[model samples]
Target: MPYDFNQQIIQEFRANRGKVGGPFEGARLLLLTTTGARSGVRRTVPLGYLNDEGGRMLVIASAGGAPHHPAWYHNLRADPRVTVETGVFTVEAEAAVLEGEERERLFARAVEADSGWADYQARSGRVLPVVALTPRSVSFPDLPEGASPPLHADRLDATLVPATSDDRAAVMAAIRSLLAGAPALGADVTPALAHTGGVPGVWVSAAGGSATGDGVTLYVHGGGFEHTQPALEPLMACRLSEATRRPAFKVEQRLAPVHPYPAALDDVVAVYRSLLEQGVPSDRVIVCGESSGGTLVLSALLALKEAGDPLPGAAVAISPLTDLTLSSRSLDVDDGRDVISRRVAEHVTAQYLAGAPADQAPQSPLHGDLSGLPPLLLVAGTAEVLLDDTRRFAAAASAAGAEVTLDLYEGMPHAFHASVMAQDPPAVAMTFLRRLADWVAGSRARGRRGC
Candidate 1:
């Protein structure tokens, strides 16, 4: 009903797609992010806008009848590239300053719509500026034939297992035994903090590694977005930390059917932002996750990008559920072939979205603009129900001008990379680790953008 601060209103607007309560309720409002002319930093402000010709939107530099134009007006004039988050779509647009009769006609139209523009113009003494934001065409990249993972020789054989296990807990236990079966924690990583972070997680480091130096690994665990394995995730993090040479924070994000949609994603973002706030460099941080956690890693990147935050050095998504709508055709084609079925996917998505639109983002990372993200490594198995989900995302991200490495393990089922968790991990698992470590090392060697 009432708002105290701009950030408070902004939080509500972002959470509700630019909607706010009280006087601004039902008003034509949008959040605008522009590069500051003087500071060379991005500044986001909430503003009202009007529709224009050819689908362009007009935003006026009224400054609420102030003596000077708003800082955003100066910022946009210096850098015409602006990001507008309208309820309908969040997009990048080129801001064109209207002049002469065009500005007159638009100002007249705006005054007719609200009468406030005229008041602001009369009160300010100078003519107000009307900038038209025209969205540019985005060319998404298509993956080449070689970009797809090579099919495993035993791929069809891996599909013969039960489509879906009835004893879900038992299935989980079996997986835990296979993945985190103790297997003697290495002497290099003998010490591990039982818990850590702004979010619930475990702090694990190798003997040779720095706890708060160089880089940090933010590891998010997967559980179909409903289940959380507090006991097992640390071991997973240990595996990652050992492989990456970075102390890993294994995030225990909130689960669904209770705290759904943004709760888990919000936890992830908070943890990452907290790390940055603590003086950790963004280019040195690596965000990695598995299954739904992988989904969050990508989603958090999108959210952070939208908020004008710096991205990480690189990211890894192992068997990610990129599309929450579960529209991937592989879900049906690999129904009985993969370990999980279409029904399981539906339940996970329904509980996680909890009435949020599945087709939209940052709930569905694949649905969001993928540009400006850090280098990404997407690992999946050909036998997975989410094969296409991961593949399609890689293609899209690549097209969106992000560096992406799509690693496919032939014939391996969902989360085949977890084989690295096994005692005396299989060759495939070791191969995955070798590539992972190499990729991460390579990311560090390159510039923040992987140049």
Candidate 2:
């Protein structure tokens, strides 16, 4: 469902009626009044504020740090003349790009305002364009729905891959056996089978193993495209395994910077194919991941469809880095959240996606076709800088006619699932995993009705 945050937020330190809540509470915010590119009217958007060096408000054109620029941002670039409104007062300003030491000093200031911005920058691997809304004067243009975001082909053909009787039996046996064992502490996670043909390097989580039940979920972990392991993700993995009451098999895939790009994607494809060969039905699987892992999940889904493999029933992502372009305006705006910085994330992106084309289907799922993938659940903290990536990706997916569910936890940090050790983590994480388990179980039941 579309978030009604603009109307639902209880607190008020206002900007525009459309201004969604972010992490920086006291930081000064401004409404950029710009003219529409195609239309001849004025449009106002509330954005996060940063005072570079001598208190000059700095706004980076990091449109959720996506590779492409946002429409409003592009409008300003076309006509540098614009107006700025801080609840205090309105002033005319010129939107000029910032670079070099001036850019660095100001970016540092912006990061100080919100750390999550740093994380966005890191994930994007881009210089994160910075702009200054300096005082100026000009007539604003009328803003209309300037243009729509990019669209990739949909991968919902997996609905064609029916669950066979034998596939149902394997899944049921895995789930029952997995449910029979003691759950792994902080590591046991809900597992589901997605495809029937077993892909190489993949194993079906059977019942009565370390974690029990019929196979209910398929889990992939995130490491920023360079450094994560299934062992490291045991906390959420285990939780998800037990919650789904199935064997949750973690893909210990290769990383980037060395292995890079499709190496990880290849492993995912290989594993899914292996499952199908083993008689696991695609409809019974739920593909999932977090951060970089989230990126892999979506990318793998697209690859599967491209290879004519059946798609999974549902998927979940925690702070998934959907946009590799790092061009969203929010990267600089939502900077207060922790656990990552835009600088670090961007660096990882540059290394992992290095040499790979920006529009490559396997490198960035955001650039792939999102239509007909599957039911999707996207969870991210309101404070997270990548929140815009989640926002845009979900919007894009919805626009593409996919069922997308998004939950933005207020004040939660990036990768909140891994931060279960952090003070006051959400009870919803645990609850969500449990719900996922039930959903997988229910889906399995539906497929086995005649069996």
Model 2: CA > 4 A from native: 1-213, 229-231, 420-428, 434-451
State the lDDT of candidate 1 residue by residue for 110-222, as single tens digits: 99989878899999998999999876421111223213322221110111111113222333344566644455555343323322345776677752565446567889999
Clashing pairs for model 1 are 141-399, 152-410, 155-411
Question: Candidates' lDDT values, in order?
Answer: 0.73, 0.59
Best by TM-score: 1
**What does candidate 2 score on TM?**
0.55
- RMSD after Cα superposition, model 1: 21.6
Judge candidate 2 at residue 437 and give its lDDT: 58
The residue-level lDDT of candidate 1 at 410 comes to 47
Over 1-451, each residue of candidate 2 has an lDDT whose tens digit, in order, gives: 0125422322243432123356635444566768888785776665666654322467876666676766677788788788775432234667888879988988887788688678878877777778887653211111111133223223111110111234333333433443344234533233344442333223334333422123335677777878863333554555565555555666777777888787887887677666656665565556778888888888888888787777876787778887788765446666644557788778888888877875667577777887777777777765567866776666667667676555555345566556332222335444445445555565457563100
TM per candidate:
0.60, 0.55
Clashes of each: 3, 103
